[model samples]
Target: MYRGTDLPSDGLIAVVKRDCPTCVLTAPVLGDFVQRTGLAVYTQDDPDFPETVPGRIDDTMLDVSHRLRIEIVPTLIRMRGGQEMDRTYGWDRAEWERVSGLTAIGPDLPMSRPGCGAKNIEPGIIEKLKIRHGETGLASRRIELGGGEDEIEAMFDRGWSDGLPLVPPTEERVLRMLSGTARDPQEVIGLCPPDLVPATVEKIAINAVMAGCKPEYLPVVLAAVEAVLDEPFAMHGVLATTMYVGPVVVVNGAVRRQIGMNAKGNALGQGNRANATIGRALQLVIRNIGGGRPQEVDRATLGNPGKYTYCFAEDEEGSSWEPLSVERGLPQGKSAVTVFAGYGLQGVVDQKSRDPESLSRSFATSLMAVQNVKLAPACDVMIVVCPEHERTFRTAGWSKQRFLTRLHELCEISGEELISGAKGIAEGGPDTLAGKMVKKFRPGGILIVRAGGGAGMFSGIIGGWAASGARGSSPVTKEVKT
Candidate 1:
């Protein structure tokens, strides 16, 4: 359903290319037909193809070929009252004569010959042609750069970068990135916060190209952005807060392997393209489309390094526990991205814990430092259980739920110790003559994801913003759409 160039209402149209052997054989005969009746000859390669023809339509740009839906060269078509009455491809002399109402169209030529593939349908050419013909429906404004301007620096000058050089989002690269998903480019995904700008599929593709994302990683980036824009995630609040936190994307299910995400050693570190680019793409979308820029709407006193990019895949293969997405209610084997308002990583090294009971106690003690040791129910936590630490629980036949429940139980403490001036530092929880017990985190405030090197005994803890649960920001998970 594309709008193409118009054709003659009443005429015999002959489409031929100089590169085709069959077209060369029938070129002279096509020229003879051009002299009789209302016959038009369209040449794809060269306008001088039929030397004897008086008028030749130069279709080197492929507008006419693509418009007429031409798949093969040397195609003869009959148009009556602006309607296609008949059409024939290749060098079939009998069929050409029948369509053109002419006898002995190519008497000296052989009976039939196959035509060459049309240039419009050549590999990777159609997308270019669609752009050239204004059929791509890409609505982003084109910023033509001056001859002296560098493409890389131009993006930085436009403030489209996150303190790093961005890949130029050219039309060719954007079109390639758009091929990753079946969704329409103009389709509006949601209104990004801070500025409340409408983010479209086309807009995301542009940012993805700038983020150096492969076409396949677009879905995970889209999912992360979708989760952020939701009401529960409170992206605007996360941006305005002085706490050190940003979107920590946890990829789960088959998409991790499909996109080659890093789930093993250095899973949270650099070196994986999917891991780095997917997170960067989400941040770039917020910056470029949503207008959430630093010192503007993104006001943070001491933002962590994860604010630039923070994304990783869970080691589903190494861990026997249910995936993090499964605990969040998404079914196993389905691809999803759960975004959490997480601060920077705090390493939890426990090399002596041999059993799940011992490990849970050690984890619970460390988890109390999410916001502050004395501040109970202040924040949430994402426990990245390394393979070695996860092995202890797996050997004891501890399910993910059982291990998490044990950690919660061990985190309970007397409310008297948490009251103001009780811990000697005076930065403690509320005190109304504290006499009861207090849990370190709110119910359902902790999440566990398996990642890191298989040999390491250390797990990472990413503390959430103090504003957790229904009021501020919650970890939101959505199924990844391919």
Candidate 2:
């Protein structure tokens, strides 16, 4: 039942659009009906639909269309005392005749014709209409704009952007985004850092809408937010430092394919909506809800583009290794998201290293340059092995464990070259740490995931924020609670 107020009592309402062929065909019939019963007709797309009908209630703004949940145009409703008695959409001669009590029909009339889609449900209009009509219940402070004010500029003036244009978080779009989760709107997920604001589901949905996320992708975004907010992830420190660090999200399991994420070919770059917006939504939550903006709490010297968004799915099908989430203790087939305090991408190109040993050696050499060439055991690293490289390892019958072991072995460096005075550095390794071999990553600290296109011989690396252990951020994995 419609909860709207002020409905017509005991009347015939014909909802129509001029562009619909069915409405055009039945316009003459409706004209005759108007003359007979004095029907109250409404036009959705164009008000000047039927020339014979004297005036059409203009529904171009789609307030009436959305209120009544009209999916198809040319809908006829028989109302009695502010209540719908009967309703039918499109044109069916026998059905129309039975409902309208009219047997008259022109020879040009067909048996039946389907109506066009309602203008309210069009791609971008519904959300805006819902907000304009004040139908959705928004808890945030509403900003009233005058006729002279531009909304985009107003958003910029209010500092609600990440150095880019944002999708207006109208009440309707936020409400639609909230539909993705069954949790209560006011339920607190966690406390976001910097200002330590409590992030509710509704607030997260608002940011997700601003990030241009589809409703189906909201769960993954929510999980990614939760992952970053987890105490172990240490997002507050990640944002406050001067290191080139930000949250790098890795989505695993069925949710990756369910949301149409890009795991192949330019996966790290732009073009995929789910991969892009999900990451952007997390960043927006940190900025808008958490109060971590640049020059304030986010004191990075040179933040990377990944700070805007750096999310991608693993190519589980294309790889021989176990899925990242499964390796991280998530049940097989369950969807999960892991957040890492990652630096930026560093390409490791090795086209000629076909064998696993030689390839692992080259990868370890590139991994040495994470913080610096001499900086060993400084921080953990996320190795994104490309498909071509994965195939080379798979063909040689080398397991993921073997690859990691070989990489770890090759990454071990002598403390002699890492010391300060030996390398002529201002700050370097301790004298007690000199002359000893240091491993690149602690046990299980080396995070590896397979992604990217089949064409590239290059794998990628994302450096960690600080040394693995009590000092730096640790990766946190959370189940997607849809």
Candidate 3:
């Protein structure tokens, strides 16, 4: 055996994945070797591989896989004192005999079998691992505060805040925030747009601490971050566009009560810690971790106050309708967070409307004018039904589907009224759309959620960005799992 000076004194390590046929073929032989020589085994994929064996080290995160530069599974390497000595890949009986020094290691084994590709190097996994644990992991420059300097002022000096005093993210605070989940602190969540900086879990926790989020809010914040960063959400475009759009988050299921998020009266407006900070944490992630700052990466002409914080839980208990997450096809009772790219909230007031059809018509009337009265089929709308409005609909026994159908029907505009030369508005609808009752939203475009106080006959409309493809953002929902 060619023993290198750097080899670990700890004997040998066997790396394998059950999915590899070669690994499966070599497992019994390795088990035999383990009984004979006490071989240290690491399982990459299925931890239960070598079923009858014990003491299998898990390399599911691929940390050990990358450290050894493993390109093939079923790799047997001799090591001593943390240093590599000799290594062999696949199930070559002769090579195993040479490496393990075991005679007739596997009498029934085939002469040779090639190994499978290491899971570490497959597609996006390597890049993600590197970003998480490598030396070059964090790209942002660090800021050191002076002894006498106020931390808030320091944040202002560095332009690290969203024009408000932020909770200082000290090492202790960040560490405490990271305690909310068992995931590695350095695990990269995804890339933030605009600057396209990598958002690691630790970095997000740091921002979450700064956002005044409680430790329990960490999972929700993480899910919201994931929701927005999803490719379908088009977070990059949402931040870069001149539109008034920002992320609107709706929390559902057990997490709403677990985190004490306000899903009832004043849900959308304010006065809830979980609701407020959860949303704020995401914005801070984009601004600090993602490098999206107004006058910098973010170019919103007139951003709304919701930009500061725009998250609320659905008032599922008070409303007769199904929870937003349930309606969106998520399993009932599963906690989730849904993120939508939306402009500021436009209040839909119908104090006089006493019935479901009338209230829905009022909503359709107001929704028709979103972005522009003529912006039909161009954007989607999220209708937040207040408790009072929800009662009216429930009393009338109107399903969400029925209400949406009526709104879609009422949103159609006459072709002549929408065309270029009409209404003295140059940015008119196309001639091709003339004389047609163009639906305002696409099929299933209207999003509905029940929230707010029981007193007022008021609902809310959150206008969406452009259409739902590459040019615009589609809402994304992610289950919040601790």
lDDT of each: 0.88, 0.85, 0.83
Off by over 4 Å in 3: 1-143
RMSD of every prediction: 5.2, 4.6, 11.9
lDDT of each residue in 368-428, candidate 2, tens digit only: 8888766667688899999999999999999899999888888888888777676677456
Better of 1 and 2 by TM-score: 1
What tens digits encode model 3's per-residue C-alpha lDDT throughout 112-226? 9999998986755765665556433343345688899999998888877888899987655665676687777778889998788888888998899889998899999999998
Q: Candidate 1 overall Cα lDDT vs. reference?
A: 0.88
- Pick out the ten consecutive residues of candidate 3 with the lowest summed lDDT: 1-10
Candidate No. with top lDDT: 1
Best by TM-score: 1
- Backbone clashes in model 2, listed as residue pairs: none
Worst 10 residues of 2 by lDDT: 1-10
Decide which is better by TM-score, 1 or 3: 1
